[model samples]
Target: MEPKNNEEEWGKTAWEFLTQVRTQSPLIQCITNFVSMDLMANTLLSAGASPAMLHSLPEIPHFTPRADALLINLGTLSPSWLPSFNSAAELCHSLGTPWVLDPVAVSASPFRFNACLELLRFKPAVIRGNASEIIALSMPQHSTTDSTKGADSTHESTDAVEAAKLLAQRTGAIVAVTGATDIVTDGNQVVGARNGVALMQKITATGCSVTALIAAFVAVDKSHALDATVSALAVFGVAGELGMKEAKGPASLRMHLIDALYGLDEAALKSHVNITSLC
Candidate 1:
């Protein structure tokens, strides 16, 4: 998954998107898992975006309208919380505020999996998840065999490329499968972000944090969902690659990663970003 000769072009494009995010400082409404709330908010702030972890259903009318973008993550799905998510997403649809969906561990159960499918009705701007989750989401709605997995993906990110494409085609959303090589697709063009350190996987909520970051990126762009999604992932990966240099372990890497994202300059981004077209 080495970048082609056009790496510089993609790097600059990504940097341009990040610049837009900083300029806009889009207020992102995130209805995410409790465990990820802190890290996700920190990730958005480090990237120069405002994050609002508002989930109360009553606030949807006022906040959702003002938010530049929204993130609905099923990482901590509950029967009680699904309606608020539905309400928020529906409002985002009506207001045309781009929203992202992170269907964490969709195969773990029936209720959580069905909740993810239901959210697809509004047609999210982007869908980010692991390979197994992507594979599960792309499966026939009636299938029963693709069950029993935890949040962790059983397969490699590359294994779900076809599924990711299929999902994007069916749902009309840019689908991103995150793993060693983060894959982004729009049912046509498939892009792979070859950045980040393997140690990133050890940190809890990194995936959730990245999804929120994607929400921030698309909040600023809104038109080029695929490019925005790729850029967010690549930028996060570049931050991870840089943070790994001074990190003693997963704990320190977490702090350093946020700092790297906060301090990323044109030079480091242009030199380190490795996004490429995937066959």
Candidate 2:
């Protein structure tokens, strides 16, 4: 395999991906939790993509097929919602539309754990989650007895690199574990991005919002999924970094982050993107 070690080469494409989203205005259908609707929609809108917060089974036949990409976030997972998630995944897989999975607190319960594994069979274009979520998700066969603290990560992002790689291999999807330094991998290759400010972590649904960002990025370039996933993280980080410059706290950071994302120019993307090959 060719080496992806050149940092500048990896970093430059961030603008291309951002530009494509602005030009294409891909429609991203998000089947996310209640808490994330507002932030996630704003995140996609700021990145110049349309966000559709639709998750009803009735609309799957008509709506999901037409979406440029789909995002299935298992944040507020329940038995009633499983059918909708499954129907959308099956539709997206059949149509070859890039879809992303955000398995929030995936191992928090046995029910949610099994649901994630079932969705993996549909082959999402990307799977984005935190270290604890990735680590728990990587073990597909193990029982859902793993004690993962709900929503928050007990482990650092670096600690889940191996697990992320293994999950990518198993699922045939780009695996991204977000933390201080976001990690992206496609089983054989790994990329790292360091740009977001620390304060962004304190905000609610930031992870969920970034997952939608990943979906939007991949939606624009379904063929180059690895690059798209990395670009999304780096771009989001750059926005957080810029937003932090004027942010007073997580609340202000959240607001400024959307503003930064909406206003990102090529210069900002070029100067702030920090993606590099980890291997």
Candidate 3:
């Protein structure tokens, strides 16, 4: 086995895996919020994946079976969407379909907290969140530093590594914590993804869209769920880094970011990714 101390070796496979997802054009079903729908849909399409927004309870079970992978984002959850979300999760569970969970603002309210807890019962293949969100989900006693109330992170990714690992162990899922430096773990091993721009947080819906991207990869590659999760995060991060150089602000960065994702290639990822320590 290679040394985990070396940061050079860890992100290699992850970068390659993401390139494949963009080239394969997998179908990913997203049960995300309205605030992120436009950006998330465009992001998925830009990454060469088909996107489907499925929210109605009457149609979710039918749609879940047809989807390659399912992404559930609790960003703007509503009472009406609850039944559909639960039904879709159950269908995905029963059908052996891989799914990702984005506990957006999980630390903000009792409704979200309970919803995430219930979703955990279905056993998501991957769980992605920011530092405060991850810490809240995995270690409820930990104090939250994020100031956006229901939308952002004030803490760095490194701060949530332990919580992410704990959550991964408890759920038997891959946990991805994003911030200045992204960290992904699967209970025993941790992979740090060093390929994003700080300006990404300045834009809205970047995290929610990346969650969908992970679902796209998981659709085709379930055996290496952690790899898929890390790959998607790294790929998205790298695109953001590139997009920032040409962006004027958050709005411009969002469009440029999508273009960068559409233009992403293996060569670009190889040259730009700064990740290390893959165990």
Candidate 4:
């Protein structure tokens, strides 16, 4: 489906998705990293969704089916975490539950690169990552190494737009490449969300948390995965901007960001969101 070209319409769509998430409170099963677990869960809860950070092989079988959506983040991957990650993804595929993949620093390690390729077999509904990660994931060889400084992106978001488009076409999944200007595409349509502050990069797990938030939005509305992703990112961007207003630094911004998300409403979105459909 083509996203609305006008900013006002897109803002309304975003607002509707946010309100739906609050009303539905979808249960999101997130198999995320240890570093981001606390913040990711808090981000979801603040945005009005139930989050479960369960990543055990035995428990996933029972939990995957019950979840409205699933998130797999390969930030702190370990040999032991593989079983649970694979199990949860497999169950999510079988149950036809929408899932989001955050291939954090996939280009930084061979294990993460190989693991991401393996998970692609299950077909994630959305793939969220930084520029370098997306570029690495979309390469034909899947062996082309890109520069990734830890979990930070070495490439700009604009540099990955074509890669993201190609990845979306190949995997049939909505792709989100986040940076200063976040981009979301579903192969056919593309949108850019410019509403965040630079201070957002100072805080850890904000990007990872956004991936989980995308999962929550997808759970509430699967048909418009592209819209859900764009909406979520826009909301995050707006919140980041609002948070910067009163924040003294990264430390304070982190606290204010969650507060902004909890207080986000249609009026704020309509007024603050700067969204544009590229296609």
Predicted structure with the largest TM-score when compared to the true one: 4
lDDT of 1: 0.92
TM match of model 3 to true structure: 0.91
Model 3: pairs clashing at backbone N, Cα or C within 3 Å? 7-276, 7-277
**Rank order by TM-score, top first?**
4, 2, 1, 3
> Residue 197 lDDT in model 2?
86
Candidate 2 lDDT over 74-174, as tens digits, reads 99898999999999999999999999999999888888889999999899999999999999999855455666788989889999999999999999999
Give all candidates' CA lDDT scores.
0.92, 0.91, 0.82, 0.91
Model 4 bad stretches (over 4 Å): 142-145
In model 2, how large is the Cα lDDT of residue 132?
A: 91
Error of 1 at 102 (Å): 0.2
TM-score of each: 0.96, 0.97, 0.91, 0.98
- Cα lDDT tens digits, model 1, 1-279, are 233347888898789989998998999999999999999999999999999999998888888999999999998888989988899988888888899999998888878879998899988999999999999999867346764366888889999999999999999999999999999999988999999999999999999999999999999888989889999999999999999999999999999999999999999999998888876
